[model samples]
Every structure is written in C-alpha cells, then in structure tokens.
Target: MIIADLHPGLPFFLGALVVLVTPLRYRWIPLLLTPLLGFINLMGWELGTTTELTFLGFTLNPVRVDRLSYLFGILFHIAAFLGILFSLHLKDRMQHIAGLCYAGSAIGAVFAGDLLTLFIFWELLALTSSLLIFARREPRAFRSGTRYLIFQVGSGVLLLAGTIVYFNDSSSLLFEHIGLTSTAGWLIFLAFGIKSAFPLLHNWLTDAYPEATPTGTVFLSAFTTKVAVYALARGFPGTELLIYIGVTMTCFPIFYAVIENDLRRVLAYSMINQIGFMICGIGIGTELAINGAISHAFNDVIFKSLLMMTMGAVLFRTGKINGSDLGGLYKSMPKTAAFCLIGAASISAFPLFSGFVSKSMVMAAALEEGYHWVWIGLLFASAGVFHHAGIKIPFFAFFSHDAGIRVKEAPTNMLFAMGLAALLCIGIGSYPWILYDLLPFPVSYLPFDNTHVIAQLQLLFFSALAFVWLKLSGIYPPELRSINLDFEWVYRKLVPTQFSNLVSAYQRFAEIAHRLWVYSSRRLEVAGRRLHGPDGQLSKTWMTGSMIVIVLLTLSAVLLKNLL
Candidate 1:
C-alpha cells in the first residue's frame, strides 16, 4: 500500500493518542514516536487508496500523493525526528505535545485532498506551534507568542472565510485550481501569504522566532513557513502577483538582517529570502518551476534546521544568542564550527552542497521563463544570503570577535542531531538524485550541468570575495545593542502609542464635559424646585366661602332671568 493512500484522519488520531499517553518525564517519546507513526502511515498508503470524502459538510480527500507532497511529507517527518532528538533535554510537556501535534498536522495538511481539510490542519498548526513559543515562559516570549498566534490563526480564519466564499460562489469545496480574480481566491492567497512571510505580514516570524527556547527554535524553523509554501503551491500556483511579492520578500529583509544583532533573527530574515525563491518558482508555474519549488522546500527544511540547530546548541550551552557578544568559539567547539560551516555552505549554494542542488533549480526556472528581473533579484538575494546567514551567522557566533567566554560543546543529543543533519546535507548535495527523484514532477533537469555549475560557482565565489573585502576593510556594519525596528514596530510601538494617546485625550475631554454637565444640571434642578415649591407664585390660591356664596347667588339670579 502506498503511504498517501492511508487515511488522513489516522495521523491526527495517532498524534492525539501520543499526546495523551506520553508522560512528562518521557515527553520526548511522543515527539520521537510521531515520525515513526508517520512513516508507518506512509508505508501503509497505496496510490489507489487516494480518494475524496465529504463529512460534516466539508469535503476531504487524501486525493493527491504525488512526488511533490510526498517529498515534503517525508522531509517533515525527518525534521520532526531530528527536532525531537535535539529537544530531548527539554522537559516542557506542553512543548513536546504541541510539537508532535504541530508536526503531525503539517504532515496531514500536505496530504489533505481539499481546502477544508487543509484549513483544519492549518489552524491546528497555528494553535500547537504557538504553544512552543510560549513554552519559554519569558515575558517577551509570551507577548510574541500572542502576536504569533494572532497572525497564524488569522491566516486560518482567512482560509476558512475564503473557503466559505468559494463554496457559496462555486457551490463546491473541492480543492482544485483557484483563480485570483475572485474574492475567495484572494482571501486564500492572503491566507497563504501570511504564512509564506509575505512582506509586511511577515513580522510574526522575526518577532517570535528568536523568542522561542533554544530547542524550540530548531522545530520552529522547519514547519510553519514551509507549510505555507506548500499551501500556496497547492492552491495558488501560477499567480503572477506572487512574483513581485516574492521579490520584495527576498530583497527588503537583507538590510534589517545586516543590522540585526540577534543571530537567530538574522536567520529569520534569511528564511524569508529562501521562501522568496520558492514563491518565485511557484509563480512561474511551469512543471520545472513547480518541481523546483517543491525540491527547494525539501532542501530548505534540512539545511535551515541544521543552521538553527547550530545556533540552538550554542545558546543551549552559553545562554547567549546575540551576535555582538559572541566570537572565536570555534577554538573550543570545533565540531560545532564544522557543522555550522557545512550548513552555511549549503545555504550559500556552494558547489556539492544541498542548496546548490535545490536553489539553482529555481534560478534556472526563472531564467528559462525569461523572468530576467526576477532572476536578477534572486541572484542578489542569494549573495545576500551568503552575507547574512552563510557567513555572518557562523562568523559572529563562533569566529569573529572573541567575547572571551569559553563554553562546553553541545550536549550529546544535540551533537548527534546536528551530526545527522550535517551528514544528510552532504549526502544530498553529493548525489542530487537522492532528492530529485522524489520531486512532484519528473526529474528531467540536472543541477550539475557544466554551465550551471560554473555560473553558480562564479556567483557564490564573488559573494564570498565581497564579504571578505567588507570585513577586512571594516566596511561591514557593526552589530548593535539596540533593536532595529521592522513591521512589528507598527504593532509593537506605533499603533499602541497612537491608541494610548487617543484614549488619553478622550478621557480628558470626557472628564471636563462630565464636570460641566453636572454643574449645569444641579443649577437647573434648584431653579425647578423653587418654581414648583408650595410657597412659589404658581402654588398661591385665593378662594373664600363668602365670595363663592355671593358669586353663586348672582349666577342663580342671572340664570332664572334668562330662562323666563
């Protein structure tokens, strides 16, 4: 039986079961078990069993299990396994349960047959993943987690709303080709956009990622954005607007990253840069482009997680993640330094690395599609990746300015996890077909062509040369202590500050008005009392019994005279 043929409901059930039975002491057990369960489900699925079903008025089918979703699903499972292994030292059961559920939901989502199924898993990812951020228990972490949840859950809501509109307009909930001209389609696109770290909507990433626990960052890096990329590919492939958005997403983050002091936050920027490539590929919408996007997603999960693991390990040991306070640690942690370098090389698209195999596909597709400007933007971002993530991360963290803090190597589990990921990075880079065969489309394009290899080498080598020149000439910006603001500044500072000022002004105006109203009303009440009192002019009366009798006698005489 093919793995995609297995019921999508099974993973959710098994994941929930794991959450229930796994104890706090062995919380990591569930995290470890989840991927195995996914693997089992994968093995049990048959291509023929891929079918669609409607339940609770929501159409769901595990219909598509082609190479694209398959590659992502398999990588997600692998990432979960590695992430769980790295996080074994974490005792937070909430993080453990949430991580498992989040990973499982991501897997389920990739295999989902329709929009409704995707939305269910999508929302679940938001809920569960936010818990990982909150697990840090820091005030910043709590606050950022709330923001993160809002953005994530908001994406799901948009997706749900779009699904409703789609069903209302089209009278169908089947997840198939969706055009961007309709309301429902745009809603879905925005929904995926939020997850894909679209410009302006992306602050949730840099805002929240660095706030997660050391181990939590490793897990955070792999799932959320990749899932969004997958959803975009599934729902909005070939949407032209994405090309511009993708370009913006890639270019603008580099400035902030260059100035960022937090190494993890810098990686967060690079994450967006990488996603831009994938988005560009999807926008191109050719078979090769789509295949490139999926393949890059596979490579990204591995190397990006590997990079995060290095940072996580460093933080785990030293409790410091700021780039300014770190340097020259490669002397003490040579193994870590080596692992980080491998990750850095892979991210930089060095020849014989995973990134070289995967990222070049997108560039190739762009050039093939005659998207010259798009290709140029991606090229510059690729160089920028080498600057911020490929070099800056490892350099500042391990080899730049010695902060004179000597820390021990990462714990055993952490090292093992990093080692495993590093080995895979090299393995995949050495033999591209190991991953190429699993892409959604047939493997017709090769990453190792002589022309492609020479061009990539030239691009990367020149970028490395630029970095060296900048560093040696003291032209590189020094990492600073103060936070450099981004889109989150709008929510974090600007909006709130404006709102508070408005409320304060309103409160002052309300108080003055209330006082004046009270004074005027009291004066009116006193005047009213005086006029309506018993001794007032309106209350005086003058009726005597004798006068009444005289008047009655006169009236009687007049009445008798008139009658006669």
Candidate 2:
C-alpha cells in the first residue's frame, strides 16, 4: 500500500516485526520512524474517511477517520514517539517491540468504527502492554503483569460480550453513542469502567505500574486508560452516573496519594485524579465539556509522561523512588529537577501551564449545567491534586532534606525526551487556542479570564499553604516502611483467606458425608439380599404346592356364591 493509503497504525505493528531482526546498532531507525510514518499516514486523510471490510458476514469499518478519532490518533502518535525516544537506551529488544505494538494497538482502537474492530485492537492493547510489564524481568513484575492482564483482558471480554448482545438486540455493530438503556450499554459501560479504573476496580493500576521497568511505566501510563476515556466519550457521553463516578475518582485518590510511599504509585493515583476531570467533562456532555476533556487528555499525555520520565530517570540513576529515600537530588540532577517541577506545575493546573487552559473548561461546564455540587466537588479535587501530585511529588523527591545519596544526572537520551515534553507543556499552556482548535467541537471558551485566574491561584496557594503548615506542625503523614491498604485488600487478602477456610470446611463436611453414605449403602445392599436372594426364606418348592391348594379353595368359594 502507498504511504498515504496505508493504515495509520500499521507501520508501528509492521515495524515491530522489523525491529526484532534489526541489529542493536541500527534498531533506532525503525523505532523512531514507525510513529513518524504513522503520523504522516494519519495526516493524509480528511475527516469522515473510512475503510471497510467484510468478515464472518459482518460489515466492519476498521479505519474511520473523523474529528474525535483523529484527535486521539494524533495524540497517540506523539505519545508513541515520546515513549520510543525515552526508551532508546534500553538493551532489551522485548521492551522496544512491546512498546511499539502496544502503541499501535491503541492507535488502531482509536480509529476503529465498529465494536468488533475496536475489540480486536482492545485485546491487542492488553496483550502487548502486558509484555512491557513482564519486560521488567522480576517476579513482582510477572505477578503484577498477570493482574494487569486479567483486568485488561477482562475488559475486552466484556466488550465482546456486550457487542454480541447489542448486535442481537439492535442488529448493528456501529460504534456510536449508546446510552445506558439496555443490558448491552451497561455491560459496555462496565467494560470501559474497569479499564478507566473505576473506584473499586482501580487497584490494578496502582499495583502494577510501580512494578514495571521505568520505561515500561511510561508506556503503561499513556495508552490503556486514555483509550478507555476515548471510548467512554464516544459511547457514553452525558451519562449522569459518570459525573458522580468521576467525582469519586477525583476525590478518593487524593487521600491515598498523600500517604503513599512509592513515588510512581503516587503518580498512578494522581493519574486517576486527572482522568476524573476528563470523565466529568465527558459526563457533562456539552460541546465545551467534550472539548475540555479531549484537550486535557492531550495535555495530560505529554505532562504525565514527562513526570514519569523524570521519575524513571531517578530510578535509573539512584536505584530508589520512595519519597522517604529520595531527597536533595536537585543539587546533582538540576535539569531533571527543573523538568519535574514543570510537570508538577502542569498537573497542579498552575496559570500559564498546560493544565490551566483545559481543566477550567470542565469546571465552567459544571457550573453552566447548574451542577453546583459537582463543580464544588471538582474544585476540591483540584486542590487535593495540587497537594499530593503537585507539591508533594516534587517536594519530597527533589527538594526535601538531603538523603546523603549522590549520583550522576539522567542520561542524554532521557534528558532529551524530558526536554521535548517540557517544551510541549509550556507551548500548549502558552497557546491554548492551538489545542482548542483540535478539539472535536468548535472552540470559544476562554481559560485566562481575571476571575478564573485569580480563583485558581487562590485555591492552589491555599492548598500549598496548608501543606506547608501541616508539614511544619508534624501533622502530615510521615513516609514509613509499611504497607498501606486500599479496597484491593478485600480481594488480595480477605477474600482469599475466607475462600480457603470455606474450602477446608467443605472438605471436612464431604468426608463425614462420604462415611455415612458408605454405611447406609452397605446396609441397603444386605437388606436387599435378605429379601430377594435365591434359596432364602419362602423361596423353596413349598411355594408351588401351597399356591395350587389356595387356588382350588378360592375357585370352590366363588362357584358357591355365584349359584346362591
């Protein structure tokens, strides 16, 4: 196929195979060019372009280029490039191959116009990304990758099941708005929810992200959940339930993130918090709200990946990531420290940062929709995010008391990736209109008004003040060498423990029941032998003579009665 006519995601997949054979010295050629070529292919199409095929008597649209999908396609391309760039130093080819395939799968999913097509890529997404986690080459990564796969594959299973039911009910496989009016919608919504890290089903992200290799976590953060966000925006916009779910997602994670010791895991919690904003905007379902969500997703990929990259660099250099263990690194890794602060400011939604321009739109939409309570909840979440992710992450990792640990700064390749991301964060923050134009809807919302700016600054300022006060007073939660539990404790610990006990009890009951059954069976067999066995009582030759005498007497009596 010609470059313009080829599928946008195909290059990455095809390049992955090529990467397998390329020598280590020359592998960068394909690793970098794949996403670049994919982006060029993606750019060749106009809106509403589609490619179709027939499979198993079903007409499928495997390639659909429209405004929404186009936005995500562009975002994924940028993310893929950044990820590949970040991981260029790794000697492990498996990580390289997995990252490319996983990126390709996410891009394919974004362009899919049919549920089946979407499902095909959805599963590829799960399988390929799992390999990245497993690339860590450790027991924890293996176990965590298993858990991650279960959730991701479970999502695909739900999607397939829902697609079947929806097709049976509607006779359509088109991917479009599906409100929660039927079983199919609910099933599909749930599938999106699990991947989206809905409140109770969220532990997989926190558990698995920290265990992956540094570069692996960067890839993990960018794709899977964001794809879920895209799906939800397309499939379940304006779902009232999502507003509340998103609120909970934003609020609950703050507490955990504040107390969590692992720096990367804190970012994981922070991720849920940011996604909550996107979910809320999508739930609002206004044009501005949808635009805000997509724009934020775009901004988030760059900034979040930047943050993960900085942490990864730290882990690579110092062999430590815990807040308690990392401190005063700014002395040696000043460039990395600077990049980390930019990411923190962006995530915290500081004025003139990437987050400021997009986050406000969602809050504005909430207010415009008269969901005052939801607006208030989102506002509170914004402050909490600043507390944990914004200030806490940078403060502890790079600025706290000296841990007496010294190491070289991050490598050149890692610094370049972080620099690129940092520039985007600033560029987008400076020119929100560029991103606003890329949104699915027409753009008119302004994020830099005096009131909005002042209000946001006040909230962030107070949040930071409170953090400082708490820390000075020694009331802030100390970083400790202990396990903190979340809802997963039920499944991870309590459920298994209880299940084992139940199995033991059932085994004992079965043993007793088996003995009683054997005893009763033996008794029944003996009784049956006594009653009907050959040569037993009343089974001899006397039976024939007695029978003949009884028959003769009965016949005489009957004849006498009849004559009378």
lDDT of each: 0.85, 0.92
Best model per TM-score: 2
Estimated TM-score per prediction?
0.91, 0.91
lDDT of 1 at 479: 80
The Cα error of candidate 2 at residue 249, in Å, is 0.7
Q: Write down the lDDT that model 1 would get.
A: 0.85
User: Residue-wise lDDT of candidate 2 within 1-564, one digit each (tens)?
Assistant: 268888778989999999999999999999999998888888888899988989999989999999999999999999999999999999899999999999999999999999999999999999999998899889988988998999999999999999999999999999999989999999999999999999999999999988899999999999999999999999999998999998889999999999898999999999999999999999999998898888989999989999999999999999999988999999989999999999999999999999999999999999999999999999999999999989988898899899888999998989999999999999999888888888899988888889999999999999999999999999988887565899889988999999999999999999999999999999998877776668556455567878899999999999999999
Give per-candidate clash totals: 6, 0
lDDT of 2 at 88: 96
Error of 1 at 5 (Å): 7.4
Measured by lDDT, the strongest candidate is: 2
Candidate 2's clash total is: 0
Superposed by TM-score, candidate 1 places the C-alpha of residue 71 at a distance from the truth, in angstroms, of 1.6
Tens digits of per-residue lDDT, candidate 1, 488-542, equal 8898999999999999999999999999999999998877778767776556675
